[model samples]
Target: MITGKNYIGSQLKAAGTKIYKTINPQLNIENPWSFIEATPEEINEAVALANDAFKIYKNYPAQKKADFLNAIAEEILALGDELLEVYCSESGYPKGRAEGERGRTIFQLRTFANMLTEGSWLEATIDTSIPDRLPLPKDDLRKMLVPLGPVVVFGSSNFPFAFSTAGGDTASALAAGCPVIVKSHSMHIGTGEMVASAVIKAAKKNNIPEGVFSNLIGSGVTLGTSLVKHPLVKAVGFTGSINGGRALFDLASQRPEPIPVFAEMGSINPVVILPDALEKNSKKWAAAYAGSITLGTGQFCTNPGLLLGIKGEKLNQFIDQLAEEIEKIAPSCMLHPSIKADFNNGKEKIQSQNGVSTVAEYKGEIAPNYAPQTILTVDGKTFLENPALSHEVFGPFSIIVQCKNNEELLTIINKLDGQLTGTIIAEPMELSNYNAVVDALQNRVGRLIFNGVPTGVEVCASMIHGGPYPASSDSRFTAVGIHAVKRWVRPFSYQNWPDELLPSALQNKNPLNITRTVNDIITNKPI
Candidate 1:
């Protein structure tokens, strides 16, 4: 059923001569399907249709939008085994991983649908007129969040289901009443096409406006650049490397009317181990970290790339144990040949650095596209001097930094770049003496973990998936959960507007019956 054509507002077209095919990384061969790249004309049509649809879609009622999102979830589930088959063949992930990611994708859509039905996310506020005040009378005012026109979502290379087309970005944008245009990741274009079909089916089933969702195929930056620079695009959502995200961010910023690009970039997800804990639980912690570093072939953005500990006999013991444990785990296939090549190149670059020593490596012969796990060690002074040691290796690779003492460990943490997560492994009473270290680590990461791995990201309201600076473009927002809808919306105010003309959430009649602040009081009652 894969047409290998672009989805331009419910219409399929492949006018461009450019064509490409996805690869089966496990088989190390191209898949049977071929996809046509979106041309300049197709890109323009998609953006134009999205701009036209936004006018009607932006004013849709909360219940209606909720219906559309729910329908999308249902249609995606309807894809059944076909979607999973495509996901596995295109990405080399196991069937279980494909199913899990598909479930997560469905859960995200349904969660947003439920949120819309509650109708309280708008944060509506109103202030009635205050006549005959001491000197000046205040006019009535009301404010609420409104959707930005159109959004461009760039799919991620690692996650085809959870972070690609019909993922969090698309679901949240639709929930915010903004049209979404997805720039499908080339490595998994087949999977992207399948998911786009489900979205289009849902849009048609729910009578949603055309161009409310689109999936465009392109292997390079040309299509992405065009979409970002388009005047009709009001915002962007991206999850990828720092270089890729930075390029899009720069393009958006240089536009005549700059737009906000919420890019979730790279992270090392550093883990700090206290002396007492390592001395007591060296073997246990080492085994656990080995599993975390190799989880998902170390492709997770939250992978523990760097581990810090005080240099001592206990630390060396932990390193030896970790190396042994990591070498035992079987090597796994990466997403694609390019990803495998990059992982090898990254490992070579780190190995070539000064003062770096390999603790252990998988010496067994591996199949093509399989990444061998590696563990390296370095001293605190050398790591601090050569910043290159801290860069993420993006595979089943981790570097342990042996600090001179607690002071050196704290200094290293202070100098580290922003990260998605930071972990502290310490004995029950060990934390009381290292408050400064805890504070510094907290200041540099979005989420701080106590005696837990950062490999899993829970989808919920309390989760903060974004962090300061390089961790994400804006720390104030997240790329997960219901709160993500806020990224595609902007707050607007109306002064002395007629009650009948005001939005339902802001009207004096309380037509929506949703929670709102009126005269500094939170209530659902009418004015």
Candidate 2:
């Protein structure tokens, strides 16, 4: 099943001479599957085909799009155990994680499918003409969101299924009626290829346009750079490192016709443990935090990398207990050796910095590519002064910042950059006392958790997975949920157009029966 070729639309092309193989991080060896990177010419062809496919796909019926999405979900499930095994082989993640992520990917497709069928995603609005007005005449005006042509999606390395080939970004763009070209991640290219096969099969089965989706396999920057810089590519979606996502944002922005790049880069999600809460249940909170920090090997973007608390007797007890709890958990392997190396280097750099002290270190021998669950502590003053300490370590590691008092803790939260999530661990009515601190956190993060860890982002309509710069390129849109489709669509208005020319959702007959605003009233009624 490993073809070692790029899936350009409906056909496989192996025109590039450069070849790479997916590595088995658990074994510290390379897998047998070899993949040829897409050439510059092939990138152009894929982008061009996507642009052409948009002409037909952008106007396709919603039911057809929904069918295509459902088919993709079905086909991925049909791949079954083979896909899960390859996912585990490519990345060092366990079988349970592989299965769970695959389930998330399938659920995302089905969620978008249901959203499309419900048709409210169109956001149709209308204002009937007032021809006989005494002062002036008001012409009939209708507005609705429309697809923005072709989109380029960069699959993530950490999530082989949920945020990779058939991830949220790709699913949302396709649901918005835009064609997609995926820039497959290098770490899990084999898993990506397997998922890409299912996508192509579904597209063919539903008779969807050929170029509606394409998967290009490239281990370097050339293919991705070319895809983003291509004139025909309208919007971009990415889930990866800050440097990589920022690079794509820069490239797309420099083009003559700049496009929107929704990059969910990275974040050091912070959790504030108020003094009262610490005093109430210091040990309980400590154990919970240890699990949160090391969950999924700390590979999650929302992993609680930074924890804040007011310095006091209770806070010290919490810190020491948290370190002890973390030391008990066994080490887990990262997705790649490079990732583990980076994690160790980050830990060392923080430890070497002036005024930073090691809180806990797991000295246990780790398996190949395994990361040690470690914790370090630094004064709030030091953490605030050293910007390097604020960056995400991207592994099973977290830094605890002990503030001098509540005022300093509030100041630190206000100084932080955008984050995917920020949590507040408070006692009863404690939140009301720290209004300024809560307000500061809300400003810096997309989502606020009252008393919970930031991991395990739910795939639902209410979740917001993007934040300000560095957390994501554009905080206005989310990379998760039904609203994510907004990133690939723009509001379009029509004036005095005939009913026959209007889209089905906006037609006078209420053909779709979706709720819409007409004459300033929301209804599912015909005009």
Candidate 3:
């Protein structure tokens, strides 16, 4: 029932010499379906179609856009169990995870739908003319956020639903009135196409333009590179490894007209454990972290890969109990064989480094692509002296750093690279005394968690999923939440223009009934 063809708008095309098949990671076998990679010509055509669609989609009424978004969610939900089956078969994830992610995806789509319906995302502003001023008269100026043309979204390998084709990037781009061209993740192209079909069906149901969405199938760099360097792609959204994201970032920057690439890359997500917390509730925190470190096979970007604490008898006991807790849990199959191999290689390299001590490693392996849980520890001096020791291993793996004292711990925390999230475990009011440590962690991470593991990210209005460089290409934008739409938009001003000729949101009539800053005051009043 799956068609291994590219969704170039509403059209399905299978014209390309390059072909690949999805692998059943648990069985280490190939799936029956074969996918045709998108050729350069097909890529060009998709971008051209998207650019054309953007011209009209950008000016659509907020209600119309909301309708399209709601339609997408409905169609996806219609897929139901079939979608979950294919997702589980291709990605080796359980039905529960697939269903949960599908629900999250649907929730995200509906959230954007509601946001657009409310008609307040534009951030409209106005300053009326002062023609009778004593000095030079001020000209009327109005400004609001507008779509930034076509966007290219690269689907994530690990997250087939929430961050793949028709995922956050696609949802936010479409919500901002920009046509989206998604480079489907090779690991789950079938799953990608399944979701892409729902999107195309929704587009038609809602009477949206033909090129409002496109999903391209590929397993190589050629497809992604061509799209990123294309002149029509005004912005890009990517979620992947550091090297992969940086490659697209560099390619986009070197284009004839440089475009923005909002890439969510690597993060260690360091967790600092203060002394009092260990003395009071060491066992509780230990049990919690054991589950968090190995959650979802440690595939989460916000997974607490690094744990910091001052050296003491209590810390040693906590470490031992935590390691034992991780080993007790069963291992799960990773998304692909390559991911398993990478985990093995990266973990081995980190373990081989000097002064590293093994805590607990899962000795019972189950399947072809199952990742074994690992917990390693090293002294603070060794970690600080060796910068290579701080890199992420990217699986159900964690490294605990034992510091001589709080000073060394803060120094180690201060020296870390940019991260998606950071955590501090301490007794009540203990964090207040370590203001400098808190500030240092705050500077290094985009989100700060107090006495909590950084495993689950809540999708909402106030969440900051992006952080300083290496965590993401830019810290000012988020790849989650409703605000994610801002990445695909830019501010535009209309100066001294007639109300009839201006955008509906900026017109003096206040047709949208959305809040606007008029003469430095926020109001929804009509002139």
TM-score of 1: 0.99
lDDT of 3 by residue, 56-157 (tens): 999999999988988898989899899898899899899999999998999999899889877778899899999988778889999999999999999998
Q: Model 1, 466-517: lDDT tens per residue?
A: 8987999998999998999999999999999988898888998898899999
- The Cα error of candidate 1 at residue 362, in Å, is 0.9
Q: What local lDDT does model 3 show for residue 285?
A: 93
Q: How accurate locally, in lDDT, is each candidate?
A: 0.93, 0.91, 0.92
In lDDT terms, which candidate is top? 1
Record all residue pairs in model 3 with backbone atoms less than 3 Å apart, i.e. clashing.
none
Over 4 Å off, model 1: none
Q: What is the lDDT of candidate 3?
A: 0.92
Decoy 3 TM-score against native? 0.99
State every prediction's TM-score relative to the real structure: 0.99, 0.99, 0.99
